[model samples]
Target: MSKILDAFLNENLQNLRDQGLYNEIDAVEGANGPVITINGKQLINLSSNNYLGLATNEELKQVAKDAIDRYGVGAGAVRTINGTMDLHVKLEEKLAEFKGTEAAISYQSGFNCNMAAISAVMDKNDAILSDQLNHASIIDGCRLSKAKIIAYNHSDMEDLRAKAKEAKESGLYNKIMVITDGVFSMDGDIAKLPEIVEIAKEFDLITYVDDAHGSGVTGKGKGTVKHFGLEKEIDFQIGTLSKAIGVVGGYVAGKKNLIDWLKVRSRPFLFSTAVTPGDVAAITRALQMIMDSTELHDKLWENGDYLKAGLKKLGFNIGASETPITPCIIGDEKLTQTFSRRLVEEGVYAKAIVFPTVPKGTGRVRNMPIASHTKEMLDNALAIYEKVGKELGVI
Candidate 1:
């Protein structure tokens, strides 16, 4: 308890409180599915990234339990050591097959995958053209790479092309890489990967797409690259096993050479412990199921459409979302927070997102429609939204 440290923390925390920026975390009492219990209250969940509802699937849970029985609970060590178990290998193989790539490499988490893969390939002598709306992980990875990061307008091809041309013609860097999220999570807009691929070719830039939010939600569960039929064109395809796959890990799918390079050079893979055998097994099975049938994917999209249509009909400003993610915009930050609080009080579990996460004055309550959410649940949620929106003068 240093006095100086205490004063600093107290000051910043008070500042956050005054600004209505401090987020209070709510714990779910049970499994976080379509409906979740929090603080002894049951509510329809609209704040999860579990696009396909595989996170609580009985089959995936059973597979994980079976794996635990066979291989124990832990990975024992890092991947470069004794931790590269059979399950891990199989999961990587399945990921490669799922992404239509030659090979794939797994990491402990999606954040680690970005931090490891980006810095491993690009160095200080390189320049990274990043999407202005890319994920925090991508931004941190680019920073770690020591590369000059040039941000282009969100999904703006012209901006990207101009930056790429300038970076190339300047000859100030040895290699240039273009990195982006396949699906911009906040807005739920799909990236223009086809145009980006063409630009990459025109400027000889290494293309990297982090498809964490896209897997199992787009391209019939293949991803944005596959959705656009440019699987072979992108140099790096990064994804998470946690989001739609219903497990916990991340991976990079690409050519054999890229996989080999990551295996040898990625510091996180070399230092951090590998994902558990159970997680690896469950993720592999999830991928298999996604590839086997499009039932969950279709259901997810159906629910998304239903929710979006309902919100629009109710007259909420549900921004330009191209996917299952829906955002009910409330321009003022305080009103946005109040709107989310009202929704929770009325049995909806959507969270309010404000500045820093999004631009100032564009605060919103983001809703994620999952495959497990039933018609009744969506209808009830919509009823609640209508009530809250009208009460708050939002509709």
Candidate 2:
């Protein structure tokens, strides 16, 4: 550690290493798609969030290449300057239409989008009613806003309603907002948006939904907000282009005024260079693919159901997943890590996620089944899981 650096940094890292929590990242030799090549091994990749299999799509790649040829590699400066390209404006327009919102604003990344949007609307005098298991980005955004953060039990509408009523009655904040992930990334649990909308209406709370994993995978490929039929009610429909959208960047779709406010106030939007034309074009095309039909979405779900059933049949506790993301729940962290390592050794590329990504004792090997997976590939992976689970006595 540098002598001038904050003392707490190394202390926390040391604590993590002492607790056997330090992770060593594995590098993929080639691009990661349905299958990945790491360490000269082609493994059945069940660890990516490439839900619709668009991450490696030739169509998206060609679109990106075309944009690069036409617009160059970068957006010259921050958006307020000259960075806002025609593709950027077009992407935002397409995104708003895709999310059924009046207007939208793009960001450098999903993490920055959270930091930007939350603080843009919320402040020290405001309060944020956040879901307990929401993404770390959401947590950090709330912290940066300097808003009083009150966590409600995960997807517990009753708890949310009670907290909202109490916050309103207390008069502690100038404005109150409820923030949640449309679908939890780890457990793949869908948010109860209809109930949340009702609660938000009862309390007049500003509603925000980060649908990063939900877009192109839910609501017949529209998103979670559309799936729940609450498109107009959610004040902020946050999403990312990197995951299912198969590109880099994030955006917030909402009322024209809210987006207009964010454009002027959000620090990241003001400071960071805008998304490049290539990424913008790529993501716009990806959204078009999703909206065209449920072909890829259906294939993803088919693969998800097959893999979940196979793991359960092997006595591996696959958690309550409603989406393509499935977690084979393992009780111990070390054992879960070992299990994933063994799976890799056997040509399966599932990764283990433990606390504090998920609850303690609920450590899991999260699998992301993509539309690109063949039934034969799925069957092979299941056989490997059975072999590994039996060897580890985890079944």
Candidate 3:
């Protein structure tokens, strides 16, 4: 009830509203699949990160229910205590195998995984070379480590090499780490990991790749690192169970020594409650499925290509994306928001990305086409896009 606090919040919120930068959340009436119902209206969903469409897979749902029936609904304590159940242990094992690592450690969420893992290994005596376009979680994790954070140009390996060489030759830090996202989410661009790994070798830098968006989508579902067959070369490979795995939680997969060290030092694992039995069981099942078949992965890319081609045919400036994530560039924030709003009104559910999330004048409506989307749904969404794009003079 402090007046100053209230005024500060009110003023900032008002500023956001005045500039049309404030976002309003829409609640889905049922399961978040390729098609979702929002406020009594059915929409062709293109905003979700359900890349492989496993989030609503019937088999995964059944497995989760069975786990709940057998193990109850929650992890009773932090992982360092009695909460490290058989399910948790099994999930870690599956993660290690799925990622082609010696061992792995899990956390409650992807954000927490970064925060816990980075700070656990790197500190003030270390320096981290990060991508300028890396995810926000990586930035926060580097900050928490209290290390010297040096940012290289986005996906520019030359810039990264220069910074890496400079940092390595400085001889001021005990360790130097290079961290980047395997796939840039907002722009849907895969990172140049192969070149990065080669550079890391020349400098003896500890390499970390956060493959949150790449898991179950790239490398035939093994991820970006394995996509280039550098699985063993990268020191730390971080993944999330939430995105394409279609469940929840995050993990760090590496050597046994690294996993063992994380178990002893990661603050989130030591202090926060573990993922539930149902989540662990479901995640394990999902990984097993992803490893077994590439059907969903292929279907996902099919839809992505279908949608992108349609958008391009209609004269929309879809960005240069190498993944299933498609961004229709609008270039102006207000118009971009208007475009998204009109799309929703016309039964599409893609959202706009503007300043703070993406650089200014690069505003876009990002579309994530999953395996569950039918050709019919994509066609309808395209129809809506053509109508809105033309009306807004964007095409």
- Model 2: runs farther than 4 Å from truth? 1-15
> Top model by lDDT, which number?
1
| Whole-model alpha-carbon lDDT for candidate 1 | 0.94
Task: Please list all clashing residue pairs in model 3, or write none if there are none.
Answer: none
Q: What is the C-alpha RMSD of each candidate to the true structure, in Å?
A: 0.7, 1.7, 0.8
Write one digit per residue (lDDT tens) for candidate 3, span 104-177: 99999999999999999999999999999999999999999999999999989889899999998989999999
User: Residue 153 error for model 1, in Å?
Assistant: 0.8
Give lDDT tens digits, candidate 1, residues 1-395: 99999999999999877777778899999998999999999999999999999999999999999999999999899988899998888888999999999999999899999999999999999999999999999999999999999999999999999999999999999999999999989989999999999999999999999999999999999999999999889999999988999888899999999999999999999999989989988999999999999999999999999999999999999889999999999888888889999999999999999888988889999999999999999999999999999999999
For model 2, which pairs clash? none
| Clash list (residue pairs), candidate 1 | none
Ranking by lDDT: 1, 3, 2
Worst 10 residues of 3 by lDDT: 16-25
Q: With candidate 2 superimposed using the best TM-score fit, by how many Å does residue 134's alpha carbon deviate from the native? A: 0.3
Better of 1 and 2 by TM-score: 1
Per residue, candidate 2 scores C-alpha lDDT tens digits across 7-58 of: 7777888886665466669999888887899989899999888888888999
Q: What value does the lDDT take at residue 275 in candidate 1?
A: 92
Candidate lDDT (C-alpha), each: 0.94, 0.91, 0.93
